[model samples]
Target chain A: MQFSGDILIEDEFLRDGLQNEERIFTLAEKLEFLAALEAAGLRRIQVGSFVHPKWVPQMADTDALCEAMPRNEGVTYTALVLNGAGLDRALAVGLGHLSISISASETHSRKNTNRSVDEGRAAITPVIERALSEGVTVRAGIQSALGCGFEGRIDPARVIAIAREFAALGVQEINIADTAGLANPVQVFDLCRKLQDAIGPDVALSLHLHDTRGLGLANMLAGLQAGVRIFDAAMGGLGGCPFVPEATGNVATEDLAFACEEMGLATGIDWQKLRAPVARAEALLGRALPARQSHVPSPPWLREVA
Target chain B: MQFSGDILIEDEFLRDGLQNEERIFTLAEKLEFLAALEAAGLRRIQVGSFVHPKWVPQMADTDALCEAMPRNEGVTYTALVLNGAGLDRALAVGLGHLSISISASETHSRKNTNRSVDEGRAAITPVIERALSEGVTVRAGIQSALGCGFEGRIDPARVIAIAREFAALGVQEINIADTAGLANPVQVFDLCRKLQDAIGPDVALSLHLHDTRGLGLANMLAGLQAGVRIFDAAMGGLGGCPFVPEATGNVATEDLAFACEEMGLATGIDWQKLRAPVARAEALLGRALPARQSHVPSPPWLREVA
Candidate 1:
């Protein structure tokens, strides 16, 4: 299997990374992370989500954070929006890119969004249409596309069907998420390949993976082999599945970049520059994160190999 | 990229896992761990290394541990030996399987074993010969075969040449080690394929990987794609390279087994049974280990996926 020549990394540290944590980052701290991410040459970043403060207290200041964020050239700053109200909030902040996602598992949809699978899809349709009519970049996402903690073994056919609907709605990208970290390499490769075939390459495919079972990077490697070039990662691996107790975070941004760069794929990410932010995050959390690359010194062979 | 249907796992938690930690396990605790491992269906285990206590104090009781270890049916117990003296000690205990290894990097060889590459090879030749004459199963190892901390970018040809020498010595297996955690997936696949071609199918190949940079399992996936079926892992991801500060441990045995089992490969090991021992190790170490599988609950999809 041939790998892509370059990879696109979208860091979701402020959003997914912090949403599940008990200690919330203030607006100032979020901006600090944003500046560091931009300076480190990360082209895509998810600032926060526009969910209700009552539901997700950590994301209460997404609008203020987005308004305060600098608009760097060549960098696309996005936020997650789950409904029309969240879309209105994101658009009010003049955000160009927005992620609107629904869960494939009916049980997960009900638990996460208080809507059944059909209800969730119906609710997001108008949000996507409104975003598209306003010329906003829409990244349609399918959560629990690989598997779910509540409803195990989400069918690939269901995921592809959801993608087909999102494609017909004229979205620019489709992101398949292994929300519960239940995906293996073979399942990832198979589902990704089938999705690519069904989507016919018009809509870009990206993956949002979690590292709960220690197969996150391995599954990412399989996704790469299946022709996926874009991935969502979090700094310091700081995220967990709120639905699954003790589930780990997304793949670490530095670790993902290191793996890609080591395999001759240009990620345009400076892993060395990520250390300060990761260290700050660790200090603030008063605990160590699950990230490996940020903690260890760069090996001497990376320069020679990459 | 065809994976082998059956995989072999050699757990080295007792040796590589504990050697670098400050805490030491008594003979009784080690026996408990050994019993747990045997009950968990581990076929091959590396109990400890026959090194001088002055260097690795944690392994000071290896001889006594070996003598007291029960000879379970269908289980192959082994220990590491660095020279003729270590070999003699291992022989004195009647260890059926012994691992004799050298470093591929000249600088690492000098630092780790206090000998040049040639001298290290010359010193181990008689040990290998003696072990062969005693009808012991010899697993010849090449450390820093992928890259080194002291001297970076070890040539794959050098690793192949060493494997050839080991094969000529009539060793049963050749284990390639990424001593400094500098190996990438492409490098691992290419080197393992070349080593397989050079050493032929008669000599088995196993990989000893570290998760220092978080590429261990990904590299293991690449090795599997390259047709390697045997791997060395530590429970609770307990091993670290003594030469590299802040370097992490080996790939977790449960994590590796979970991945293999998820990918339709039979590992003949029960990952669930490993939790008790891993928890014990964590408690004894007074810290959380780098293992993901032992911390998280088994996903409901594993039963359906596998």
Candidate 2:
């Protein structure tokens, strides 16, 4: 009863999990996985990215995956687009939910997207405009929003500025990404509070996190106390960036669900359906992932384990 | 600047880490590991438990470990005990710092120590007397203190009764343990606040946590905000209760230290130096021990890789 609110979970297993693979899934495999997500009641999913396949062959079937994903009345399917060009492709597919990312650290923005923070800002402007005109939802993700492995420390003001810019550009949501998992709870609480005060809830906030330094959930908890309701997670903790060395995986969906339920926060997720996705993911990856789902006898574990 | 006070790190790698082992470490290895902990600037450690070896064979050598541990000027070494017999062994070894535990739930207490809640209470009285007479620093650990895996939920009043008991015993400290990892942050903060209000800080409070569900550090952060300090952690994410099947490891010491340091809290521990003990543990286990150390750098791969 202490946590009196509902939390939303969005799955990124397909898009993020693909990054850690050696071979791209065939169209059939991608469709099978997408269908599995739908059957499992994984409502909102970032199914794939619209970047060039030459650079990220792992997401080669972005277009096909988008077209093949089963639709549900209550579900929202999303795709990641780092720039205007990718947004164009996503728009062509009639995407209503879109995510655009720019690392808060100037160095990461340049290396990952070949743009400085300012240039990244300029690039995302058109995408935000298109989304508003097309009546689509845009969420600007400040990558490496918490800490920069390469930089040692990240300026929280830089992230706040980026959130402010996206808010001005009509972005409906803001995601603070711990791209390298360098954030602790205090930093998370402080930074989330700053973003919350700046945006005043005009832009809904979510966190796309990594378990790199193992404070992923701690950071999320801090964000939750700051009024964050949406979270991005992967099943079986499967997902990491192939381009980024040492990128482990996204915070596991099952683990986050467990924490929320125990806190009396409602996530509207049936964790039993998630286990099959985890098993399927491990089979696809040909190995177990980093973080395992908790073995507690919560509703999900009861259904899955028993 | 917002976070007040020094960050204290108490390593339980020797005591708790040994719980999850398929094959326990040799006494020589434990001694070597203790030396490594001191070298890492760890000023306090829960070295071993004085419980009956029949219950936890991994800790049968508690006496040998205490006798062999290299004593230091500022370092404080503590041992976990159950009753007078264990206290006698600790006193014989000249250990001033000691921990006694009883599960908050009657069911778990019965299974954990083969004694009912009231029965467990009756047994520890003589143990407390001996420790107080010897001028020992005593910490009464109340386990399953938050929520239980066996029992559905725990009442805060039960915990209050235990705290009142410890206070009456003239014990110096109380450690609230989420033995089954059932706590969420809100529950943690509320419970700690209630416990502190019921029993003033006559007994300095600490937390011993298990990450069975990945909310270990989150719960600890909540306790800190509630004005509770002192905690226990094992190295390399190793821990479990032999009696509690499939219980996960304790919060990893290196990971906890890194989290506190990142939060700008001072935990008087050199995480970089803490690596040696973990390495020894991994080598002996012949499998990678899951922890945050060497897992991933902060964020912004752009800088670290550059």
Candidate 3:
């Protein structure tokens, strides 16, 4: 009952959502999504991932995305960078906000990059330093923060240790990811609490969860109980890891916003407005999006109150 | 930290699972699904709903299903009854168990069944009494237990009152349903605790959650945490409600069981064997079932151990 008011949510649909599309959109189509994100009152959006074009052809437009993004005076548009090279490319395109990821599971880290987790960490630390040097706000992500399909359960201790390193490296934020949908509410709450305890409130705690096990929103609510103010979600549940194997989309942005808003927690988002991005993306994907809010009969309140 | 084991999940594919199929399965196909359910190690299942053929033509084969169901020892096959007439039909068909539903949201009750919550309750209480006299196990359900699209928020108090009344009527179980996916972990945990307070351990607590908002498994976890056992899920997530309009499928039974088994909980159901049911349903629906576990490769542990 104590939980109320608008909470900040970060939309990862562009970077995370584009993973599920059968047909990769033109850079223009991708920007259409970004413009919709801006119009939806979303304060933060991850527009593109800086992975190599050869590896993920869908995200080949990352450089162009940064240049073409709809500029909102207060909105934070982010480019997800892998290492220093990706960070440099994002920075050269006038991208001032950045996210770098390191997998908590060693197996996943090695699969994601040909390096071990520690090596991935070694690679990302300098990007954090460089982002700070360039005055680019950096949010360092601990992928597989909850569990891994390849390696199974990830150690919360490793996640905490990584967060401490990121905090020390002056990363602007820390996003903990349950990359494999293996997280439970207790684990999510516990991890968020521990990460916050280690890093304090200076770094925002952003949670990225998957719907793989039906714990996506449950885990988000648990993190909310642990005082996490930020979340990552996709439009129309479009996004999954090309590497995480069975991974589906991130928690859908509109669904998350609806849950938070209806529960009296403010998401600063209009759920009705959030549908546009997914609808736009549907043209690119051909198939309908996975899950959608029920279309039950007209709510009398919507008509009467308004 | 106390939660462990595979959660006990009951597949509802036969009864509530066939709401909007383009074509109803013949008694033979339905029998095949039941066959798969038994092989999946399902100890409990809802095989049919005794509603009017005109109202729900897809379920017109209720009596046929009762006759053709593969009789397996110790597997509890239940049927849904909407009114006294339906209950009479179920009793005539020799159903051992019955599930009766009353909505927590008055608006939904009126629109869905042309009765207010109290009137719907009135119409069903005698059915509960009549079923009990015949030694049939009657489980009362509070539908729209979370929130209703038409009604907005469902008061936990109303749900408790419905649950309390049903418990007093000698019902064998109480199912708290997120008829709409408007529940979060907090709401689920809190509501389950209240439901337990109203019904206690003598009457089993069941959950019928829809994945409309992707919170089905999360709500199920909340029920488990609150000491409620027994869950209702659909195979391959193949369901939507023609009654409610655009309702998503029940929680995926395989996905739920996998989550539960991995956590070391005793569900007494075989997770691996349930894949066939999913496959059969997918073929029947002429589309892929919407389940995360379906897309996943066999875990290395399973292969290594095998």
Tens digit of per-residue lDDT, candidate 3, span A1-306? 347756888888888888556578888787777778778788888888888988888888888878776678989888788888888798899888888888988888888887898898888887889888999988899998888888777778888999999999888789999887778777787788889999988888889988876668878877887888889988777778888876876788877887776556887776666655666667667767754541223233443522
The two-chain DockQ for each candidate, comma-separated, is 0.63, 0.52, 0.39
Q: For model 1, how does the per-residue alpha-carbon lDDT over A1-306 read when each residue is reduced to its tens digit? A: 335588999999989999999998999999999999988889999999999899889999999998898998899999999999999999999999999999999988987899998889899999999999999999999999998887678988889988998999999999999998999898999988989888878889999999888888999999998889999999888887566554579999999998998888999998778889999999999988889887776787554533
Candidate of highest DockQ: 1
Candidate 3 chain A has its poorest 10 consecutive residues by lDDT at A294-303
TM-score of chain B of 3: 0.95
Q: Which candidate has the top score in lDDT? A: 1
lDDT of 2 at B100: 79
**CAPRI band for model 3:** acceptable
Error at B205, model 1, angstroms: 0.7
Q: On a 0 to 100 scale, what is the lDDT of residue B40 in model 2? A: 75
* lDDT for each candidate structure: 0.89, 0.79, 0.79
What tens-digit string does per-residue lDDT give for candidate 3 at B1-306? 347644557788887787578778899888888888887788888888888888789899989889877667888888888888898789888888888887888877887678988899898888889899999988888888887866677889889988989999998889888776667766887888878877877988888888776667767766777787788888777666666664677788877777676556878766667666777777777878767676565444554532
Candidate 2 regions with alpha-carbon error over 4 angstroms:
A294-306, B297-306
Interface RMSD (Å) of model 2? 3.8
Candidate order, DockQ descending: 1, 2, 3
State TM-scores per candidate.
0.97, 0.94, 0.91
